[model samples]
Target chain A: MTSANSARRRKPFPVHILVFLAPAFIIYTLFMIYPLLDSLRLSLYAPDVNRQEVFVGLDNYERLMTNDLWQPRIEGAIKNNLVFFAIHMLVQNPIGLMLAALLSSQFIRGRAIYRTLIFTPTVLSVVLVGFIWRMILSPLWGISTDFLDLFGLAAYDKPWLGLEETALPTLSLISVWQWVGIPMMLFLAALISIPDELIEAARVDGATAWGVFWRIRFRLIMPTVGIVGVLTFVGNFNAFDLIYTTQKATAGPNYSTDILGTFFYRTFFGVQLQPGNPTMGATVAGVMFLIILAGVLLYMFGWQRRMLQVEF
Target chain B: MKKLLALAVILTLVVALVPATTQAQDKVTLTIESWRNDDIAFWNDVLIPAFNAHYPDIEVIFAPAAPTEYNAALNAKLEGGTAGDLITCRPFDLSLEHFNNGYLVSLNDLPGMEHFGPVARSAWITDDGSDVFCVPMASVIHGFIYNQSIFEELGLEEPATEPEFLELLDAIKADGTYAPLSMGTVDLWEAATMGYQNIGPNYWKGEEGRLGLIDGTIGYDENGFVEAFEALARWTPYLPDGYQAISYPDSQNLFTLGMAAIFPAGSWEIGVFRGQDPDFEMGAFKPPVPEGADTCYISDHVDIAMGVNAASQHQEEAMLFMEWMTTQEFAELYSNALPGFFTLSDHAITLEDPLAQEFLSWRDECESTIRSSYQILSRGEPNNETQLWEVSAQVLNGELTPQEAADIVQSGLEAWYEPQQQ
Candidate 1:
């Protein structure tokens, strides 16, 4: 009787646990896990000249890395994708942090209104944002020129969205404008969660506002920073909409704005008269997965492992 | 009282359903799946009524998806056996893919197939030319569309030669009353579709060059292609200020708003132009031939067509409608209703839109060719169509010399194209 009781106690299995997990597990498996595994499997094979799916393990990767036709495009897309991520990290995160810092301050006026106004673009459809921005920046009919003229900067105005050098960076800024609210809200939540005693103790030590932010608040929110960084990395690497909307699938002006997502799309669905190659597309997707996986793993193992989460 | 009311309700229900059940049997309904959603009103109000005039029993429904989503959506519907009987065919490999996959049936034995010549049917034919899958509906001609008032204001005449064309643009730019060219590279296709393909045929010698490319006798780096790029390069100076940032719609607005003079355009823009500004006087001129060239070339590319879905239950009714499409009445109706979309039928229907008529008149005055890249060359990596857009844009942007642009396309083609390998 004791053994039976102990066995039951040790098991600690509640049948309700599975009952609770069943719906989510089944849905995630069907939608996410299955497609991901299948796509990974597809990367290992390609259609032969006779259109038969034949095992050609690592050949697609080899070609993607080395073939004259594909290598440059892959390299270009990766390079552009890195630039895209860098822009987010360098510009978006810092601005978001600043906004959160400002909004959290006791001196700021109408903080709620400012927060709502800043966050308004985040809820707008990406397509609508792209369309509206395209019109606003249009050289022929755009009001951007007039806006610049008001600042005595009319001569500096160029088709920032149209040029090869400017297209990606300009798009990055536009994306930043649309998505800044996410990181801002995240940082705000993190700031609010910080225990008041720690901050009050720092204030008692006569720490300046800047010193408090850098030494106390920023250090305590390191975990959130890591999360936001990983999220931005994953999001920016997979981004397609704004670029696809603005530059098209070609990633035009000599493919200055081509990212892995657009590249994968063009490969999978083809563009113009070029027929889609599913196997090759899967290979591109496989590379993208590797890129995002590496970033995530680095965050989890490298960054998060070292981040000291402050206890209340 | 309850029994009497129940009985009365049953009788009325039977009466209502009686006609519906009978009508469902003898009346065959045909749906045409098309990307031309803009023409739904025309199809319903004008073309369908005309089609109904001959076969009153056959009911036609004009079902369409957004142009960009049509291909994927149609394929999905086809896979599920729920597609329309008649499918609007995108030209070249896209339709050819359908036939190969058995989504579209061979229309080789259709009686009306005789009405189309090989050129009109080329877009839908099999690789070995054994089967024609779609009936060609229309082809859009590429040319220069200009504001008639702007031309008059500048005292400019339609140029017949490349030198004269440049001179006219120079005159307009000098006057500074309007932007000389209202085109942009932001939408890369405009550079290729309206610019390179529009004028490339002149330098490449039309069908001779196109057939040569198909036959593996021509190289993109050759004089013809390079010269076309050179001509495209010269167009940069006259383009609208800050042209690089301009998009297709922006360029259209510029032209329509009378801030720009000339728009390199496909004939399909006629309806759009008219729709936007009913009183806007527009004139189209054929792509000017280079100096000392006796034969002028124009791109009269097949744009759209209709095919029978192999899985559709009502193939007979669909074929009947397709047959009627080849008739003179349908041709006249289609051409008049959709002014810019000229019918592929042999019937020489008069166009009411002067700009559209002007575009059609080029067929008589010049040699006609499809976009050189569309048929087969675009099937592989470094797609000719896409490459043309990028290279043409780069060349116009002065980022690449014409020679470099030509070389890029040639080498890119050589990478995969078996013929270009040599």
Candidate 2:
């Protein structure tokens, strides 16, 4: 060990580091970077009248941006995607934070059971979740009406999954329910890592429980909050399976529930009657990539300055 | 030079003939790829055994993928050069693209191609009508499947006109014993398929309106198309309570379980209805014509076909099987076994099931046409079929008026279809 260290004391250049990184680098490149670049390349070409692909020099993107056929669809998808992301930030994350804060309390009983129960839905497949929720909201089979009647709210028992106004929100809530566990677990980990002595010291300094949480515990866990937010931003933007599974490929009720992911899938793979358009599909995918990249960069540069971890 | 030429000719002949002779001597296996996983037993137990009795040397395998994944899976298999000798085709553009890519061989010169008429061959033929790729296997006719027991108990006769149809529906609703119509807008396609297309043929005059729309001679906002939407809108009151949330399966169950009196259906659903219960007798009736109209039209849509893979190693054996499919015996076997999928060939076969026979009898009673959005209109940005599904469902949901629904369809078409721009 001494000899190896002495050999590269001034310069830490080493062949072993490259060897160690080879597996991950090769995997990430082949699976992630290569296909992404290829898809980007594919987005630049369009099929002419002869059905042969030709280099169109951003004509595909131009059509997607300006043409009457795609402009509204893309706009609607972006608008819906914003709504989807907002729901996660506004509803999912806050509930997760509250659950974590409560579960972390010393006086709370059955913490493990509550934690496991909340986490169970996260482990279930999105397909199963969509199926179960669709049934639960279904007027014919679901107990939603009966359940509502118990609270004298039977008048509110309209089909949430079928109506245009409520369909997107219903799906969003289903997604939030399945995913709230993630942020809770993350916040819980960060909260437990907090030194008990520090909290005790704050109490000795005549701090209320609420004051200690806001000024001490929450301040210490700010980095986790940033991580949770960004994670949700990425996840919500890429969501397709739940909506697709619940509302078929057309995302019906006049496309009211369509988001960026379902829009891309419909454009790419098509449903019953329409055929796939690979070039245009690739263009949508490229736009998705840019949107995600811009978001990550924004979060990194503007949202948080430091990610100081609590180490003991 | 002459001697050398003769020797080269002899060598080439032997090389070609040797493989042919070797292949003929050994038993050959031909695998078929299909999306009809539901009919696996029908293919294996009835059709394969019958085919083997005639051609004992060739063994056949029936392989299928889930219907939803068939297109992507089939493309991957074809690209990898591992697709089966026989390929089951989805109608129109799906199979047409395969022919364009040289995945399927042009079966124009094949002997049994003459048995099919232009109407049957229209689905798998080239746009210019020079080449036919797939052998037309089956078509599903559109009509109404109703509960016979309920109809008998209510003393309701089959309605022959639109006014009578609505009157019967009113009577059923007044009775309060059963839901008048078993249909839903949740799946969207069910609305377009079983509701709009079922009744629209009488309003649009079928082929003329469909062609006019394609040529831009007819806009969807016109009387024919608008009236179709009006018909769908009219059905709103007769539908089951909470029909907006009811899915395709839910609608089917409502009829099958005797909760609903009538189900707008395709000929494809006959098998499912037959298996429900022995006591539940199902009845079929053609879509009622307009009040003053004399002629009636039906949507006899071509749904499935079979084609040979151009890259198959055993094209000769596969072509033999294709030739046999055109025979009368195969037609009788396929129609009786499948029940709902009426064989496309004009073999004058008898249907054993009363409901299927009744559905088939409408072909002679009405002029036959296909779904309006199927052919050339659906290849663009907002798929015409997909648009119809949305508008038709919304019309039933009361989200859009009939005129607004028609305008949405018309504009969606004009955005891409050139003739519609006028």
Candidate 3:
């Protein structure tokens, strides 16, 4: 120990700390925390014709789970969401990871050009992306069909964005196309950060390039994969703008594309026949929050700690 | 004596100048909300300019919303306490609830109340003859729009009777030139609108017909509504194949491209159709009411109205703007811009379109045409119209017989109101 360091450092005053934190704390409380708590309180009630709300704790929740009109809608939305997420995981992330690995490789050409082009869609507003896709897929426009005919798969051409069976999957593909860049960049950073010495050492030990990548590079990036998965799970559930901009509240031919967000919108504001019901709307919102919370908790407890926790 | 004279002069100046300055300061600003772009242009170009010229002190603002987003956005604004000073709405909106809550001022004794034509005024007035809750701006007549050139080419005259109409439809089909009517039922309401138009003539049969089905005095399974449904069902064979899968724009295209002889739609489409095909010779008539009825020509416009907001600080300014809106000048402005719509004002203007001219001439000769009941169903209660849509779709799909579909409508309405009872 150095004998010259004799003075002790004092802890900062609590008031000084509070002064530094107050503005952000106040803003967060007002906008986020209070509104969330208020919504949870509101979900316990039901609307009456007199514009008064009556308390009916958990009855809304119960009815949502079991009611004929509502239960099926909820189940359908969940299934659609899961399918949407799975497609992204299967198609988007793996493609992104491969591209990232290739881009990080020393021999790749025009890396900057590819990166710029791939990341361009991510910067666009979801509404613009939806409208652009809708126009491209329009039968009247015939661009999509014309493109497929070049590959001699003209017979396989479909009104993929319009039909009941293909609409949701097409929308998911669109979402994946827009968002793949985010994970690609994350993987690219992780890939690049691997020290050159480690790969050199493996190569000197008579390892092949593929062997070096699997043994050293892939293992080092397990933490990034975990982060990406959690990000994807959260994003899938919170999605509203793409579906809303494309489908409107009715969500197409027989409500095929209706999701929890549109459901909440219709219930809260009502449509041509149903009057607006705020409490029910709040209940839907509350349930959505709970669903997202449960997802995040699962990610933290099951995946994040296990994969990312480094052992010395 | 000189000092006292100066004080009196200063006092007189203060008294005279104070009110004029205050009145200038109190110049009220009022806003009107609507989703119709054309109507917004009319307000900006014609109504506002005229009103401002009349009352230079008052300022008027126009806030237009997109069509699909209008209702939901308006409701959110109302609930969130940010609605405009004057809201553009239809009669069937829950304005009655707003009136009961004292959000809407009673227009009973408002200046120019007596000028509101009966058809225009009937929607906003209370059933008990208490007060006028809204001011109607225009009346829309709903019926079949047919290509006149096509009918003429086939040597078919416009049908004036139900059997003649069926004959005319078959003749068009036999000619193989066109389908009878092109329709889309994807949204559920198109079929219901068609059903209402078909049922309108039967409505005047007193308590035995349409009224009984609606008010629950007689069950929907009653013979009259069943006949009405069957009448609607007759058109099914004439409709395009895969009609259920088609959207509104697709159906509109079918008609505009002359794929069908007729389209069961609102006269509002007269502008839209003409815009698409300037030479598309088209004419409309009340779908022939039954052979012998008290009111044979039954066609009415759905009500689109304007109201003063409850929270409006400038009620006088809003009312003044509304009063000018229903005047003859404003009426002609709207009529010239969008033909086939009759303004609320009693005065008339000459329409250049031969079909529009014919509609007006027919209305002039026939005074007792019953309005379309679809409009009533639209503004009445929620699910009432939706039930009609669902039942109509069921009827079209063959899952339910006509009478069963009627029963479903009745039961659906009953279920909707039952929650209120609890």
Candidate 4:
């Protein structure tokens, strides 16, 4: 009878559970949720002639989409962001997967050393990476040109970072080089988590090594792949530091390297001769937030549904 | 016993509060914000000490931001109501914008302003020429700095006309020993500063042309600007191959290393050039005009000016510092520290540096006019400085003709102006 009474008392509302969740909830609300909501609120206002913020109610967003000075830049940034994401998905992820596969293999020697060397760039500051790459690629110094001349490919050498056609792709590739380590490490962990006995079973049943990898290992790592894809998408869309450090706040050579991150920065802070408008900047941020939210929802609902958790 | 304890606490509070209030009254710190990060040492060692020598009760702090990031940071600080006591003021639109937004304090009744001449005073004055918003610091003259050794080696003289200048560039190019011009358009502003701002005035015919532009009586597609664009295009061939990939610092490196013959820059760069190569003998020449023009007009304008922040807690102290800054003593020190920067004071501060003397000579010899750099005269809508840089870079890259570039600028100006009219 005493036990039944204790059970019916509802465990005193689980004070310990509340205690555990409180810190994280407070932090998340203070840092992330408050700022996000503030930005959304700010998007509804515009600066008047006196530079005082006044509530304009959707005018900023409408102007951002329709204004001559802003519309093209927004569209261009969105397009560049897609290209940036596509490059990572196609090039960075595949290379990471291949490297992970090789490094995780039992036959490969010095796998640990290779892993350490590859991940070194990921730990370096983005500013340092951008500056170092800019110096190495500078045509004035002739470092890149000299390097290319050694293989008799001097004709192919140009100011890749300065040219309008090549600047964005070149920057994207540099970003890929720095970040490929993240996906590689994730894939390597996923690969290691798979029981070796399953592979052995597949091989013993007359399956080749490639077939074992294709049918067994790849199938087991779909969940990790989905996570990596979503992470890459989010990171690519939110990218700013690298482009800003390299090309400056203008994102120029005629704004070829412009992405949503740079666009948002320029709108918020202004660059060169462009004066900042906080209202428009907040509007841009709100749009970006919505886009990212949609992407996250799609991943959770559609991709997560198909991703089966592999049991050991 | 409780009453006794409360009395003890009250006595302790009184003792603490008295000294705190006295200390606050005895000393004040005035913060000065500027974009001249390179001049921190000068401010720390020289200016601060000089200012403190007079007003020992007030301490001065020199806060600096990089030139590229200065405006944005300053705007943020102003918006947050936390800007410094004294603020550096850019000429024209930026200053006007800040004034309109009530970020600056009017200095119409400030002392030492009488020392400023008509030109220096007019720079900070309102459009109606009644109120002054800032105290003028120094006027910088823009021209080409050439390697004296290279000119001696090549037996070249400072050209006095546009044709002569082009001829000199041609000769230098034909020599093939060094780049004729050390200019990097990669930063985009280099071309605008070197070619447009320095040389454009000579083509535009100075103040008359600028006034016409401001009043909408003239356009960028007019004959003067077209000629200026042509002159800029003419200099492109003398630039090094892959010049667009070379940054401003790299271009300076080339000039200092003797890889280039000429560098077009403002007088503010004299100290920089000297620091890079102490023994590097360089000579200055004002941008030459067409042979039949009235006179070669040199680009002269106040480069660094200071104003008191309206929201500052120490307005009286800031005004004191600014008044001290405008004195002849400060002028001499400033000119001594940065050789070629001419003081705004009508008082004759003797020039020690040969380069400063030469620039002074140029000023005396030609019709010196206020520099009408794109932002200096615009309505702040077209952002013509940025447009000029972009179009100038395109011209250098051979992607656009001078005419096409002129048309682009004209269209931008029209787009900005049409809306204002409506």
**Residue A182, candidate 1: C-alpha displacement in angstroms:** 2.4
lDDT of each: 0.89, 0.88, 0.70, 0.83
Displacement of residue B255 (Cα, Å) in model 4 is: 1.4
| lDDT of candidate 1 over A179-255, digit per residue (tens) | 99999999999998888899999999999989999999998888889999999999999999999988888887788
DockQ of 4: 0.51
- TM-score preference between candidates 1 and 3, better one: 1
Q: For candidate 2, give the lDDT.
A: 0.88
| Model 4 lDDT per residue over A1-312, tens place | 999998979667878988999999999998789889999999999878777899999898888889877788889999999999999999999999999999999999999999999999999999999988889988777588889999999889888787778889999999999999999999999999998899999989999989988899988999889999999989988999999988887676777889999999988876565666778889999989988888989999988877755544
lDDT per residue (tens digit) for residues B1-422 in model 2: 23336545544543564454346447888878899999899999999999999999998889887887678668766776667889999998889999999999999888877877776787898878899999888889999989989999999989999999999999999999999999988899999999899889899998889889988899999988999999889999999877887889888888999999999999988988777775678888899998899999998888888999998988999999999888888888988988888888877889998888898888788888889998888988788998999889999999999999999999999988999998
lDDT of 4 by residue, B152-203 (tens): 9999999988889999999999999999998977687877777777888888
What would the per-residue lDDT of candidate 1 be over residues B43-148, giving only the tens digit for each residue?
9999999899999999888978889767767776676566778999999887898899999998899887788877788799997899999988999989999999
DockQ of candidate 3 against the true complex: 0.25
| Poorest stretch of ten by lDDT in candidate 1 chain A | A303-312
All-Cα superposition RMSD per candidate: 6.5, 6.7, 8.9, 6.2
Ranking the candidates on TM-score from highest down gives 1, 2, 4, 3
Instruction: Give TM-scores for every candidate, taking all chains together and pairing residue i with residue i.
Output: 0.92, 0.91, 0.76, 0.88
Query: Model 3: how large is the Cα RMSD against the reference?
Result: 8.9
In model 3, the Cα lDDT at residue B149 comes to 78
lDDT leaderboard ranking = 1, 2, 4, 3
Q: DockQ of candidates 1 onward, in order?
A: 0.68, 0.70, 0.25, 0.51
DockQ of 2: 0.70
Best by TM-score: 1
